[model samples]
Target: MSYVTKEGLGKLRKELEQLEQIERPKITQQIAEARDKGDLSENAEYDAAKEAQGMLEMRIAKLKDIISNSKVIDQSQLDTSKVAILCSVKIKNKANGQELKYTLVPDTETDLKANKISVHTPIAKGLLGKEVGETAQITLPNGNQIDFEILEISLE
Candidate 1:
C-alpha cells in the first residue's frame, strides 16, 4: 500500500482516466489501422503497434493497481513537531551553510521539481521523528555523510 495526499490521488485518477479513455482508444485504433495494411508476417507497422499496445496496457494495469491500493492521507491530522511524511521541513546544511526546504511525501507523490522528496530517501529517513533544532546525519548512496539542522516542521 502507498500513502498519498488528496491532490496526489486526484492527479493519479486524472492520469488513469486519460490513459483509459484517450490513450487506450488511440492505441487500439493504431493497431486496427496497422492490421489493415498487409500480412502480419512482414508488416513492421503492425509489429510496432502491437508492441506499443502491450506497453500501454501494462501502464494502465499498473496505474489501476496503484490507485486501488493507495490511501489518501489527511493533512489536517499531520503533526508539525517532527519530520515525517507530508511534513515540510526546513533544514540548514551544516557543511555549506545552505538552507533547503523539502516536503517529505510518499514515493507516488514525489516531485523533485516541487522540492518534495520520498520518505524512503536517505535524507528523509534520517530526519524522520526528529524535532526542530535537532541535527540529522544523513548518509548518501555514495557513502558521503552530511548533517542538517532542522529549523522548522510544518504541515504545509
Candidate 2:
C-alpha cells in the first residue's frame, strides 16, 4: 500500500484522468488512421502506433493500481515529536557541521528537487522515528556511513 498526502493523491488522480480521457482517445485515433493505410506486413506507422498504445496502456494500469491502493495522510493530526513520513526535518552533519533540511514523504510523492525524499531511501530510513537532538548514522549506497544530528522537526 502507498501512503500519500491529499495533494499527492489529487495529482495522481489528475494524471490518471488525463491519460484515460485525453491520451486514450488520441492513441485510438492514431491506430485507426494508421490501419487505413492498408498492408499489414509492411506498415511502420501502424507498428509504431501500436507500440506507443501498449506503453500508454501499461502506464495507465499502473497509475490506477497505485491510486486504488493509496491512503491519504492527514497532516494536521501528525505527531511532530519524532521524524516520520511527511515531517520536515533539519539536521546537521556531525563531521563538517553542515546543515540540510529534507521532508520525508511516501515513494509516490518524492521530489528530489523540492528536498522531499522517499521513505524507502537510506537517509530517510535512518532518520525515521528520531527526535530532535538525537543522532542518526546513515549508510549511503556507496558504502559510506555518515552521522547527522537532528536539529529540529516540524509539520511543514
Candidate 3:
C-alpha cells in the first residue's frame, strides 16, 4: 500500500538486489569462515556470524515483501491541483516568513537530508490536499501550532 514514484520504486529494487546478490554472499562467506574455526557450542565468532546472518535474512525478507506490495505512481498522470504524495511543495512560515521546500513521499522514501518528508509527518499532513495560496495549520510533535502558506506545488 506504499505510494511511491517510479524512481523511488527503482531505488528500492536496486537496494533489494544489492542485499540479495552482494550482501547475502558476503554473509555466507563470513559464516563459512567462522565455521572453519570449529567448536560450535561456545564459538563466539560463529554465534555472532549466525546472528548477523539471521538479521540480514530478516531485512531481505522485509524488503522483498515491501517490493511485492509496492505500487509505482506515474508522475505525468498525477493531479497537481493540490499537495499530495510525490508533489514537491514550497511553503512559507506565516510568523517568521521562513520558507522551505519539501517533497511529500511514502514513509519508506522519507529523507530529511534530501528534503523529502513522509506524508504522515505533521507538516506534510497539514500541507496535504492544500492548494497554492492556502494556509495550513500544522500541529508539531511538541504540541505547538504553526501556520504555513502554501506557495507552490509541482511535480519536480
Candidate 4:
C-alpha cells in the first residue's frame, strides 16, 4: 500500500486526467497524420509516434496504479509527538554540531530543494519513532555513520 497526502493524490489525479483527455488525443492525431504520409514499413514518423504513445500509456498506467493503491492521511490529525510523514523535524548532528531541519513526506511528494525527505529513506527511517532528545545513528549510502539528536517535532 502507498501512503500519500491529499495534495499529492490531487496532483496525480490531475496528471492522469491530462494524460487521458489531452495528451492521448494529441498523440492519436499525430499517429493519424504520420500514417497518412507514407507506408507503415518505411515510415519513421509512425514508428516514433507509436513508441511515444507506448511510453505515455505506461506512465499513465503507473500513475493510475499509484492512485488506486494510495491512502491519503489527514494532516490535521497528525500527531507531533514523534517523527512521521508530514512532520517537520529539527535535528542536531553530534559529530559536526550542525543543525538541520526537514519535513518527512511521502515518496511522491519528496523534493530535496523544498527540504522534504521521503519516509522510506535511510535517515527518515532511522528517525521514525524516535522522540525528542533521543539520539539516532543513521547509515548513509557512502558507508558513513552519522549520529543525530532529535530536537523537536512539529506538525505546524
What candidate 2 gets wrong by more than 4 Å, as runs, is none
lDDT of 3 by residue, 1-156 (tens): 677777777888899899899998988998898889887888888898899889989998988888889888788888989998899999999999999999999988999999999999999999999999999999999999999999999988
Candidate 4 per-residue lDDT over residues 17-95, each given as its tens digit: 9999999999999999999997899999999999999999999999999999999999988878888889999999999
Q: Which of the two, 2 or 4, has more lDDT?
A: 2
The order by descending TM-score is 2, 1, 4, 3
Q: What is the lDDT of residue 45 in candidate 4?
A: 92
lDDT of each: 0.93, 0.96, 0.91, 0.94
Per-residue lDDT tens digits of candidate 1, residues 1-156? 999889998998999899999998998999899889879999998899899989989988998999999988998888888888999999999999999999999998888999999999999999999999999999999999999999999887
**Candidate that scores best on lDDT:** 2
lDDT sort, best first = 2, 4, 1, 3
TM-score of each: 0.97, 0.97, 0.95, 0.96
Residue pairs in collision within model 3: none
How do the residues 1-156 of candidate 2 rate in per-residue lDDT, one tens digit apiece? Answer: 889999999999999999999999999999999999999579999999999999999999999999999999999889999999999999999999999999999999999999999999999999999999999999999999999999999988
Q: Give the TM-score of candidate 1.
A: 0.97
Between candidates 1 and 4, name the one with more favorable lDDT: 4
